[model samples]
Target: MITAPLPLDEDLRLRSLKRLEILDSEPEEAFDRIARLAAWAFKVPIVLVSLVDEDRQWFKARHGLATCETPRSVSFCAHAVFSKRMLVVEDALDDERFLDNPLVLGAPHIRFYAGAPLLLADGQVAGTLCLIDTVPRSFDPHDAEVLAGYAQLVERELEVRSQLIRLQTAHERDRRSLAISEARFTTVFKETPVGNALVDLDGRFLDVNQAFCAIVGYSEDTLRTLTFAKVTHPDDLAEDLALVAELLAGKHTAYAMEKRYMRPDGTAIWVSLAVTLVRDAAGVPLHLIAAVQDIDSRKKSEKALRNYHVELEERVRERTAELRRSRDALQTITDNLPALIAVVDRDLRYRFNNEAFRRVFGTPSVALRGASIQDTLSPEVFESLQPLFARALAGERVTCNEVRYRADEERVWCTTYIPAEREGKVTGFYVMSHDVTEQRRTEQRLREKALIDPLTGLANRRALQEELGAILTHVGAVALFFIDLDGFKGINDRFGHDTGDALLREVARRLAATVRAGDMVSRLGGDEFVVVSRGVADAPGAERIAQALCHALARPFVAGGTIVEASASVGVVLRGTGDAARSVRMHDTLALADAAMYEAKRAGRNTWRLARHTAADKVKLNETRYPAEKAKSNAKKHSEF
Candidate 1:
């Protein structure tokens, strides 16, 4: 056996590996696809993109391994990382270095090994893309070339992932800075004294500052329902409409003229009004910013003196100065948000949109205003969403989840459509949307963590009980095997918990390998595990599974430089297919199975005992027939182990 040598630039290699920041990340489909493809190409049972950390080799993507990592001392990938070349060993038993290796002598029994070293962009070796098999095999030059190409794929993926992380970090920083700027601008808008209002191109009020509501003598809610035409005096309405038409036609950027407003109680007030057109980034008119001030006093006093006219003119100038601050603040707030905030009328035409809506639809927010949804969204998207929008406009508040395609990305969004109503009538809907893809992914990960055992990567007690409950609910025949490792406590005392944990992981792998493809194996916390086999036709089939589990657990486990032998005393129970038989509760079944497991220990170690419980007997469970203390009695009898 030839012991592997270290690389010449080991320090540089370690630094480069750490810099990628790919270790311990959630598995990605890109890397998993590479591993699966390699396994299929080589006709090997296992393939891994293994990274060599300081003390272990961690698998980023694994094709067949149950474990995600292993100590570096036993890692075959550790030897391959020494050079940027393909390393292949046809057989390990014949090699000097592996002749006495525990991996060669125990479970998984690796004989064939091949690896191609993966390198960073800086030309430092980080790890290897490796293939392994239990049987010895030979490879040719073509095979080596193909394997080397796979290494290049891994290197490119790592580089791309690192770049994406950097880009995301920079984007977050920019967003934070923009938020700060928007907040400062919002403060200025709130503090300004001028009567400023933002209205849709069609003249409906979208937002109004406090001063605007005061000057109009209407609450904000009331103003939202009334268009500029509704409040304008009949005599001045024609002139106001003509000026707005000129602005929309691009013949005028703004228009100012004195206008008469009719109050709620049949009174008329004269005001000086200046309206400016606001456009989005792409130079499309979006909103009309209107500044209004009460000039009735000035008009009435005009005949009294010229001094009053000068004083009123000076006040109007001061008000106009403050209006500029409000406009700047509104623009800043709308431009920074990624959320899609918009309003649409009963006619299905857009009334307003924030910056994100413009970016996604590939149209300026100002230009998109007053356009139909069918015109803004793709045909497929429009057809699917039209009904939801209609429901909102019909006075139904709606919230729904949707996935939409942006230029080159798919994003999950939670959208809420609120009905904008006035005087008990629905006028339009307010649409607000925000991305929820990352949040949903996080929730899924948390659910997986709860169900999967962190130590062995198998199902845990929670998963086992849930599966059993599901099987019972569906009324299926099941075989349950409760396995307790023999002498596991002694092994922990003698070898330490780390080795004990390693032994358990290896044992779990063996148990999983022994079961049929559809069987469920779970670790029920420390030294105990349960196997649930569904769709079993008879007790004999379950007995065969029990026998297989016993023989598999009797094998030796290699961990922490030690070859530890162990055995399992398994208790088996079979439930037949019938409503009555499946009606048994999960806890009672587990308790009966546990009682039977202790009986197996008494019968002797390294064997299985089947506990028989009929449908009628299960319905009549009590201390008299199958006493609850039977497990304790069995344990006390076999306490010498």
Candidate 2:
């Protein structure tokens, strides 16, 4: 077999493929859906989104194929990538390049192959979105265009994944930087010479540095129990209280003054104090951050020290405002996205949510924040999602399809959970969900169209094959009835095509009504119909069903104001015993039934014949004829069987 040579830009192409970070990753539904759709559209046995690596061609998404990868040397997709275009092989046996290929000679037996090369954003070929068939078939230009369109979809999904990875990398880098910044701030707070404390609006200390505890001459726990008012000198209390009130009232953001603190020994020490009020996003006061420096040694330098403290407080306020603006901007971007996005902490409480999430769940921002997941979602939904949440919290990235019924309408969602990890532990998880209701409905409709006969609304030929295959797996006796209407062509020739169609519909209805509830009825195109009945006890039981069906269609059908008389010529096959039954495949049974049908037609029509398998695995026919007297009496009214 001829192997494909590597492209001149092989190194660059490999680099681009690696940059996607998609090789050997778990299959994603988005990619799997594209592969399934391509297979369905092409009616091929296999479809794959193959990414060509240096040593192997890996399947990112595969349908109807069991293996995950194949060697790159004999890979058809590698050639497609190297050529940077679609490759089509109508018949591998006829093509010299693939005639000796292992895939063509062995399992899966590739005969017809078509691949559309997947191109990355950088113009490097990754691989192909390919279709494979065991039989040789011709592909027209339109088919190529369709394949190319599917390839484009794969490229787009790859691009989206690449962008998401890049974004996550940037986010992780930013988080590490923030952690470093916090670490530095913590070191400064604990080890700095100047005293620093975080105080609530009521003047109680929420937290204090070691320097603050030393300056106050009290332990950290002791300072937490005492309010600033209780520790301030009696002479300085009124002025300090006045300045705090003005800060709360927004008269000024920061205030600096000389204050005296009465220590445990009742000795007062003068200090320069700078206090700044910190507000939330809505400009509500949250806390007061204070910095104290000893001014007892040089009381004359109080003004200079106060000015320095005031400037420092102003810088702190500006930094706080800048961080808030950045946070608001990020929130805005997330809020406008179509996907419902949320972050849930380890406790299963919502730590963050986007506007889309709030709207979808019908919860307000204030109510949703810090709300338990169980409380935010309905009981049923919460229960259904609990396992997924647990898996994500256990550090598994999960993707699943969820269906919900709301107000009598079915809504489908595709959801993904990505764990947030810090220091080798899962701290939280991110939720992203997209509404896929329309897409799922469309797929359902397509499936229905494929299986149901549009004209008669009965199971079609394809459906019959699938059902028969399943029925043959069991050991029970099965009877297959192949019915052909006697003189359907004459009726069609005389009454016109429209009346013929109406008559066929009437026949289909009668056949369906004649069969048992467990039986299956199908129309196999062009005036032929089939019925499959399972659990039959013997050949007589099978004959009885065929007779009933023949009798049902023997009745006259009135269509388009024209009365048309038609009778059925049915060929029935009863599944045989022992080794013979095992050897009788679905098609073999169908052929036997079809041959018996012709026997009934030759036996004069309006009759049924049964075919059974012999020990030699050959079909033997048994004819069951109608009574001569009954045939004579109904000869003019109905055709003889």
Give the lowest summed-lDDT range of ten residues in model 1: 304-313
What is the per-residue lDDT of model 1 for residues 139-222, given as tens digits with 9 covering 90 to 100? 899999999998899989999977887799899989977674554344223323346677898899888867677777888899
Each candidate's clash count: 2, 4
Off by over 4 Å in 2: 93-96, 163-191, 238-255, 278-287, 295-315, 322-641
Model 1: pairs clashing at backbone N, Cα or C within 3 Å: 1-96, 1-97
* Number of colliding residue pairs in model 1: 2
- Residues 291-310 of candidate 2 have per-residue lDDT tens digits of 88787634643543443343
Instruction: Report the error of model 1 at residue 29, Å.
Output: 7.7
